[model samples]
Structures are given as C-alpha cells and as structure tokens.
Target: MGNRILIVDDEWNMRNLIKIYLSREAFQLNEAKDGYEAIEMADQYAFDLVVLDVMLPDIDGWEVCSTIRKTSEIPILMLTARDDVKDRVLGLNIGADDYLIKPFAPEELVARVKALLRRRKKDNREIDKLLITFNDLSIDYDSRETWVKGTRVELTPKEFDILYTVAHNPKTVFTRDILLDKIWYSEEFRDLRAVDTHVKNLREKVRKAGLSFNPVKTVWGVGYKFNRPEDQY
Candidate 1:
C-alpha cells in the first residue's frame, strides 16, 4: 500500500486543499482540526508522514511536532504562512523534516513529498546492507562507504551528498545551481564555487577507488549525472 499521511490544520479549506491533490495521487489520507484533535488522531493510527499547519486554536504546530518527535521518527513536513528565514529555521530546529511556506505550488508540494520519501527509503537501510551497484561501481549511504568493484573509496560529507544525489537518480542530469540547492540549504548561497568544489572532490574519490572514474559525467553547459556506459541499456 502507498503511505498513509495525516494533515492537521484548524482551517477546513486548507486541510481539504492538500487532501484533494494528495488523494488524486496514491496516498491514503486523513485529517484533524486543531492541535488537540491532531494529537488524538495521530495516536489513533500509524502514519507514514504528517503534514502540519503552524497555526492552531488549541495549540501550536511546534509543540505538536515536538510531542510527536518525542515518541516517533515519522517524517514531518510543516506548513506555515510565514516566509521569514527565522521561521523556517525554527521549524527545522523544532523537528520538521521539511517545511513549505503558504502559497506554494501543488506540483512543488508533490515533489517535496516524493523527495522526502525517496530520502527516507534510501536512508532506512544500513550502509553495508544497501549497496547501489551499477556497472563496476557501488555506494553505501548508511556506512558512508563507496567502492568500485571491490576497492574502497573516501569521500567528504559534501562530496558524499553530491554523489548520493546523482546516484539516487542515475542518468538524470543536474545543473550547477540544482546540485548546490540540493546539497546545501544556505539562504545566502551567492558563491557558486561550492558546487564546483564538491564535484571535483567526488570525481577524485571515485578515481581513487581503483575504478575508471567514468560514472559522474558532465553535461557541458548543463550540470552532470552519475551515469555509466551501460546506463543506456
């Protein structure tokens, strides 16, 4: 079955708004109004994800998120009317795995949901347990270990994030800005060199593993993709 998700908000329209789009897809959906009812419904059933609104009459979303995190590791994405950077940081500090400010595109909402699920699915396994194998190379996210055939490789945290992002979506080209945005969450990310630095590091690491280092391919004026010669087959 697809994941069941809970949407908690005091406004009926807001709750139903998300539900309408989500239900059109494959997710099993449920809703609760106010923080008290939200907690009650959450306790009543197991949920794969929680979409919470910040404003509630009975209580705030931050407290509800804190309470949920105290007992469970279920992924949470918070909804807020505030677009302030401080508000976003606060939500992340409080336990929201992700956040969306008001007036976001439904397509973006769906994309964020899918990204979170993909991240969770990839992260839930032990590094030694989940090896991403293609051609002669492999990467283990759980252990932060990578290899070409049987030889080991070393990677920095940023390099690993870069590698992991492309590896998860092999053959999908990414622009420099796309890679930077995906790997880092800096609000003031004007220095574009960070992406270049990480890509250089990742390429060297793959080479050090005794492999041909042909996996991470550049797209000329575009960005790059983690692809092998056999990816076309």
Candidate 2:
C-alpha cells in the first residue's frame, strides 16, 4: 500500500486542494476538519504523515503537535497563514517536522511531504543497527529503549534520539544547531532551546532511574557532549 497521510484543516477548500495535489502520488489520504477530529483520527489510525494547519476550530496546531509528540513520532507538516519567524520556530520546537506558510505552492507542499517521508524511511533503517553504550547508560535504537545503571528509563522519541546521538559520539561537542540538524533534519529555522528542553527531560529521566551520574554535559558557550567517569582516564 502507498503511504497514508492525514490532512487536518478547517477549510474544506484547502483540504480539497491538498488532496487533489497529493492524489497523483498514490497516497492513502484522510481528512480532518478540526483539531479534535485530527487527534481522534490519529489515535485510531497509523498515518505516515500529518499535514496540520495552525488554525483550527478547536485546539490550535501547536497544541495538537505538542499533544501528538507526547505519544507518537509520526512526522507532522504544519501549515500556517503566519510567516513570522517566531511561528516557524515555535512549530519546529513543538515537534512539527516541516512548516509551510499559507499561499504556498502545491508543488512545494508535495515536495516537502516527500522529503519528510524519505527522511523517515532512512531514519528507520539507521535505527535498526544502532546500539550505543556509555558506562552504565545504554540505548537500543531499534526498540527506542534506554537504560541507566541497568534500570529502564522512559523517554520520548525525541529525547531518546538526542541522548543516543550525543552518547554515540561521546566526547564530541554538538552545538544545539548541529543536534537539531542531525535529529530534526530540517534546518530552515533553528530552535536551540528545544535541544535544551529534551536534554533536561533526558537528565531528569536518567536521574529518576537511580543513576548517580549524568552522561550529558554542557560545554558552556559551545554546546553539549557526553562523557563518562572512565572517559577521564
């Protein structure tokens, strides 16, 4: 079967237009007119991507994106009439994979959709062989599982990726922008603070797992790097 995509927008004409453009690509398309319906559809179905509009009758797209990120890493392509830099950064920080301003070309939207799906496929393949360990911190990429001090640690998908990326390259300093590029893969706009948020969550989770040390360290004015006690030797 072709890729499944959900289009969430309050405007019928907009949804129809997107459907028309994507119909030529063999996608199994679904539509939701409001954020409420979007969430319901997302919960009930496994979509390859979601084209979400910022304005909705119920919850806004940012809220929907944040809520979805809480449970799923399904790629989101956000649409908005606002082209402000802050809005774009906010969307990316909240977990939208790509952002398109309203009045965008249909061709551009299709291209972005294709790119996101392609990246997702590549990422899945990469994760299958990923296993990184630093001292007592261990991460299994395929299962998206992490352990610190031999105890399981729960993490959001983004958090796990951030941890794995830094830990896999221990002692290597990764600026926030570099981390975003490596993980998010869309660099049109940058959100350095988002990296900090995930790192904070990762550290808290590891701490709660009874681990006595932090594997991730800030470089102060640079970025972040992973280090272990034995790395000192």
Candidate-wise lDDT, in order: 0.82, 0.90
| Candidate 2 runs further than 4 Å off | 131-233
CA shift of 79, model 2, Å: 0.4
- Looking at model 2, report the run of 10 residues with the lowest lDDT sum: 127-136
User: Could you estimate the TM-score for every candidate?
Assistant: 0.54, 0.58
Tens-place lDDT digits, model 1, residues 133-211 = 7767777876877777788777788788788788888868999888777777777564567787778878877777667
Q: Each candidate: how many clashes?
A: 0, 0
- Tens digits of per-residue lDDT, candidate 2, 172-231, equal 999988898888857455689989999999898898887768878888999999867575
Relative to the true structure, candidate 2 reaches a TM of 0.58
TM-score of 1: 0.54
